[model samples]
Target: MSSPFIVVPTYHELENLPRFTEQLWTALPQARLLLVDDASGDGTPDWVKSHLLYQKQLFLLERAGKQGLGSAYVAGFSWVTAHLPTMEPCTAVVQMDADLSHNPDAIKDLLGALDAGADLVLATRYRGGVRVTNWPLRRLLLSLGAAQYVKLITGMPFSDPTGGFKAFRPEKLGELDLEQIHSDGYAFQIEVTHMAWRLGWNISEVPITFEDRAAGVSKMSTRIVREAVWRVPWMALHRRRLKPRTESAFAQKRSSS
Candidate 1:
């Protein structure tokens, strides 16, 4: 039996949960949705319980304070791996946004990539037909620049290295050295993926339309970007990613930005 689960981290996103539930139920009927919430003061937990659609197919985890995206995911993954052990077989553990930047339609693409034997599948906006809607030019450039820089430095073939929406093979859970991961923001994604690549896990990217959130203020800040800047190379040093990819057009972009 194949079991796939999605981990959605939320904070004051009461308005969008219904749509997320609806779309996931439509797109991947076989999967379960886990909402990792950071004690959203906007009655988020109560709302999740009240909704008929959300009540059945979804489960919620409440944290004491507002944990960043990476920490929420790590906690969710820890719970998922422990409760739903893959000792019996392969399961897909997928992560995406609660606000719908990662389209429901893209779930199939990520799953299909996993089916084709990839250890992980990334929903990449920078890969081909993927598009970014409503994002300012500066934001777009910065994001793409970060992903490209990671690739150039680490020689990663993935187009959207910083993308949040992704699927992981359950068996790969054993490979996760959680102690090595020290990211709470963008670095969270960067560190894990880089480690996966270093471990020689097969990864693939599915084109996706990256949309800015419809109802929430942008959580991303200059601190996140600056953190990525320092942490990435620091990771490179520790992980020995010094080998440059063709002189790094990505690095040039990062420096210019």
Candidate 2:
């Protein structure tokens, strides 16, 4: 199997970047990382450019301003897809946070699930039980409630639908019309996974221990939460428009055979 590419979106994350990259590289030395910075004035881009290791293993995408997390990820994935043929090919495109909230050590479990034939692997904090660490009670409750709300609104059965830690097959990631994903914040997570599920992709979940970020402040805002609140049901109402990509590919294969 080829190495995976990790996409991390950052804004004012300088305090956490060094340690995060150290642990990430230690865990998956072969993997390459793409850090999409929304012009974080905290010397983030400068740090990336100056780091010796980053010269080969890490790539930076500097945006003009604070674009939302969803758009940053879309841009990163699109970069990977466009360059994979010319650059070193990767087996998967993994998306995670830069604040050390998503553990790098658990990345192997996600990749292992992909090797086992899952088209998309979600690093879940609620599969068997809640596995979050160092989070306040109210925040934990909010996250749990959001998961339940997503399932109730969208009829998607996956636990932790809003979790950002996930791995995607390169081809499947490439097939997505990134322009159609207009959501930001939690809604973006739900929308992408919902699209894959609707397309009959083989989705699976792996339990992971999610931790609160060790450094820097969170980027969450009331606006983001409000967006998710109204977007969930909208996605459900439009589910009929999604055609199963897997079934279409299978049909083509059968016809050829």
Candidate 3:
């Protein structure tokens, strides 16, 4: 009876967890959520175990200490692939933040994109002219600049490669070396999207209105930014060396022959 799982990476998000589950269920009642918490010492684990554990669709993975966003998702994906029995109509994995910044209502759009033959659907803030709300000018510029920089380096045309709101087909996701993804924070988002593109998944960017979190403090830090700054170029170089031979490339080569 397993189903498509939504991997939500949480860290000290006690206040947002309740509303997150509520809104998410209201939107997609049948969807399963895997809350990967990185030792949020604020009783997040206890609350989820007490209130949500009984639900057949809700699950949690508790880790010791803040183990970066990339690893949390890698763990969640591995767990789902290992433990969950794939059923009909369950073809994709979702990744989103626990904070309300990413609208729960948009989950349908993302999944719909997957159903419409998209291997990877990215909920982009820059798709339809900067669809973000409440972000200060400086932060907005940083995000936009980062996306542009990623595009220039990785040669991926995604408008929001750094965006966290995305859906991926399990088949497409399985092609990636998940354990090899070690970038933290926004860098992880970029790396995953680039990896999917390199794997030749049909990546579609859907416009989403990203709002600032209403309840919790932001997690953006100099360290995370520094990591992305250093790692993105290196990823570009690595991608150049180990370019995945996608089906399209193979078909083109055969046709030319």
Alpha-carbon lDDT of model 3:
0.82
Q: Give all TM-scores, in the order shown.
A: 0.87, 0.93, 0.90
Query: Taking the tens digit of each residue's C-alpha lDDT, what string does model 1 give over 74-186?
Result: 88887776656323233588999888888887888888899999988888888775499999899888988888888787677878888899898875754677655767667
Model 2 regions lying over 4 Å from their true place: 244-257
In the order shown, the candidates' Cα RMSDs to the true structure are 9.5, 3.5, 5.4
User: Residue 164 deviation, candidate 2, in Å?
Assistant: 0.4
Per-residue lDDT tens digits of candidate 3, residues 88-121?
3355689999999999899889888998999889
**Cα lDDT computed for each candidate against the true fold:** 0.78, 0.87, 0.82
Candidate 2: worst 10 consecutive residues by lDDT?
245-254
Task: Evaluate model 2: give its lDDT.
Answer: 0.87
For model 1, what is the alpha-carbon lDDT of residue 52? Answer: 66
Top-TM-score structure, candidate number: 2
Q: Model 3: how far is 253 from its true place, Å?
A: 30
TM-score of 1: 0.87
- Residue 176 of model 2, lDDT score: 64
Per TM-score, what order, best first?
2, 3, 1
